[model samples]
Target: MATSRTGLDEEFIGRLETSLDIYGIRQDPSLPPLQQTYMTVRAGQDGSAGSARLALPAFKGDKGDPGDGFLWQGDRTSAELAALREALGTDQRNWAYRNSDNNDLWVWIGSRFVISPDAFGAEGPEGPAPILVGGTVTVNGEALDQPLGTRVVGSDGVYSLGVDLPELPKGEPGDQGEPGSIFSSPDITGGPTDGQILVFDNESGKMVWRDGYLGPKVYNVPASAFGDWSSGLTGTRHIITAITIPAQPYRYRLDFDGSVEVSSILGQTVDVQVRADDPDTGAMVGVAYGNMEATGWVNQRFHAYSPDPFTPDTTGIRVGVVEPGVEQTLHVVAVKSAGLAAAWRVAGNGRSSLRVKLERMP
Candidate 1:
């Protein structure tokens, strides 16, 4: 019985092989209905092969149930569509068709109608430039009208705005601020007194108040007081004019302008001196000198000045110390030169003048 079963199995295998030879495998057809069917073989958990049935349908299954459809709101104008959306409420399935003249298709999506393929219309012609009308400006509820013919022209518009604003009502005065320092500073010493001026003190590196002006003082010698002098003999000195300077620390400059007349052609020269004299002692404290050469008959114009600044000796005389209203006198004098066989004279009438300039040095 086993031998017979073996013979039957071999015979069945031979018949299966013969059938495959008779109908060989061909390429899959392009059409879905005529395509060859394949059964999927999956590996089981035990590593054994597992087969699944390949069910190929002779035709497609019956169609599915239809979904909710969009109710056509019809082709309407924008105003009409707005009215229809208001009437129909938020029915999202509702839709409307619109031609190019009326825009695109729109669907009502609960809140509003949204257009499909949202596109803009053709651009229209540009409108005329806007004209800005003139108006008044108000400040604090007070109106100020625009001035006549005052127009503000802008790039796109013209306006007439009032340039002047209405004056506001006066407000209450504010509290006064703290007093500021006029001359009271760290760099300045001593309080300001009446008629006293500020002067920088080098020793203390501060500004101090001085009794007199800090600037230069000028004194002009009176022309009427100048006297003419003539000396036939040499070594004769004559006073021309005098200038009085106030009691103060000063550097003096003496200037003399006069004409020298040489009566004798043999006269060589005449000496001119600016001498600072102590009024109390009649003693000359400082002297600066120059000379004029002889020019016969014709009066030779001469100008003389102090070679250096003259500082009065404040420590010498009682008048030198500034307290008792001390004063210093500067005298302009002319002397005939020694060893000259001539007569020389300085004419004081309208040809002689002297000026004294005093400056504060300390």
Candidate 2:
């Protein structure tokens, strides 16, 4: 390289450093200082050749013919005015509906505003909501009976004009029915006696009176005869006593005592039986048997009865015994009859006898 003594090269390098610093070039290490161009012009002229300057031209000319207008905008014609009038009429008649006399106003939404009934002379394009004032109002031709600020209720089914309605009056009661039938009392032919009471007899369909006994009557008969004997009677029923009853519907029972004496050496058999007969015919009605076996005096009791509801041939009982060769006598000691409503002695000695009783068993 050749050296210069004039300093022009130094000056040129200084100017380049200054330009890089102004452009923030070194911090952007990947690029060199940017390239640029310059123009030469005289101050106060806009590069135009004429008298005009660079200042924005005074907003000239009346906004250069203000441009087009909206959808329904144009010069009005008779047909357009007629259509508008028809629209206003339809809105008044349908949307903002009112009766023919225009006494009331309604807002059907989609209609122009109207003055409220209570505003200043009630005049402005009144808005959608209506304010009520003192007025006559009718719904479905039935006039309301209420005043302003009072809630109006519609007719429930009955129709009425504006007059207040009153409640209806009540009705009177009806008359009574006639008396039922009654029969005459019959004559007292064989009237009720002293202790009798009146009763209705359904079988005869009549009222009558009678004395009544309600249930079967019972009878108790105790022993009225008793005796003891020691005679040796064998192999036969010796008659010791008897009791008699009348022929009728009766239940007969006999209770008695009998025994046999026996030797200590031999086994002996003694038998006792009851004999029932018809006293008038001497024919037997029934019989019951019993026995005893022992070495000494073996004593026993015997109770007997005829079949239930028995009408034993004029009924009578005979107590007898058999001594089977043991040198002993069978004794009939006590006897009694329990039956239908009667008691008496029938037959036997002072040593052996019977008592009778009669019960109303039926």
Candidate 3:
């Protein structure tokens, strides 16, 4: 070694240092030559030619076609590539493309997406729809929050704001929509009972009844006869008053009261009774009775119910008192009924009064 740097050595060493960017190299040199090749020059002497095998990089074949509407944009960053892939997978309506360097991967969307004036005004699909950039839309001289993407439709050319419109002032309600059909008393049938109110049923379109008054009916019986019973009286039972009950079968609740003044008849037992009897047969229908020891005055209150669906006597009802046999003046005071007609005796000498009230349970 004369310490001379040979051309081969110089060239070989120089080639190794310089970076070379190669593409489209054959993977298998053993097979027939492809559209690529490898180049070299002879190096050794002495009738024995030597060769220096060029170390080749990993073979990479030609890139396949990028397919329709797409071009290879070189290598892409993971984030950019991921975003592109995501946009593609998310919605087919999304149109994404890139420049040659695969940077700033831009996404394109159809006109029907988001709110835009151009999309709103798009009448046909033949032309490239308008693009949405920084800008708001206004309609009818009022700026819109956002342009409505929906196709504007209607003969009058009214455009939808596509946003919540401010609530409008409510208009004055149109005069009371005429009045509902009037209902009259005569319109109802089966004459409503006393104290029964009328009501209109909207569903049935008819007049109906709520109910008749349910309170107890009171009848006043004025005293017609009042006097102390003399010992010589003909009978033990003295009729104080009588009320006429209609022959109709009606349930009745009879309430009565009577007061009698007795003098010097202490410890004497006196009886008072409200009796309903048939004036025709002199038979009793129903009776409520009470008794009290004679003193200065005896007050009695009695109540009775006729048999269920009780029918009153055909003639009338009689309220009377059973006198105590002795020398005592029995001044009959008052008798009252809650469910029968008024009946009483006006005694000039004594206080006699009876009141009856009649109620129909049926």
lDDT of 3: 0.40
TM-score of candidate 1 relative to the true fold: 0.35
Task: Give the best candidate by TM-score.
Answer: 1
lDDT of 1: 0.53
Error of 2 at 315 (Å): 19
Off by over 4 Å in 1: 1-213, 249-267, 278-293, 297-325
Candidate number achieving the greatest lDDT relative to the actual structure: 1
lDDT-best of 1 and 2: 1
Candidate 3: worst 10 consecutive residues by lDDT? 321-330
Ranking by lDDT: 1, 3, 2
C-alpha RMSD values across all candidates: 23.7, 29.1, 20.4
TM-scores for candidates 1 onward, in order: 0.35, 0.22, 0.31
Q: Write the residue-wise lDDT of candidate 1 on 137-230 in tens digits.
A: 5557766554323344454344445343344546689999898785767888878654477888999998898765555566666556656667
lDDT of all predictions: 0.53, 0.34, 0.40
lDDT of 2 at 90: 34
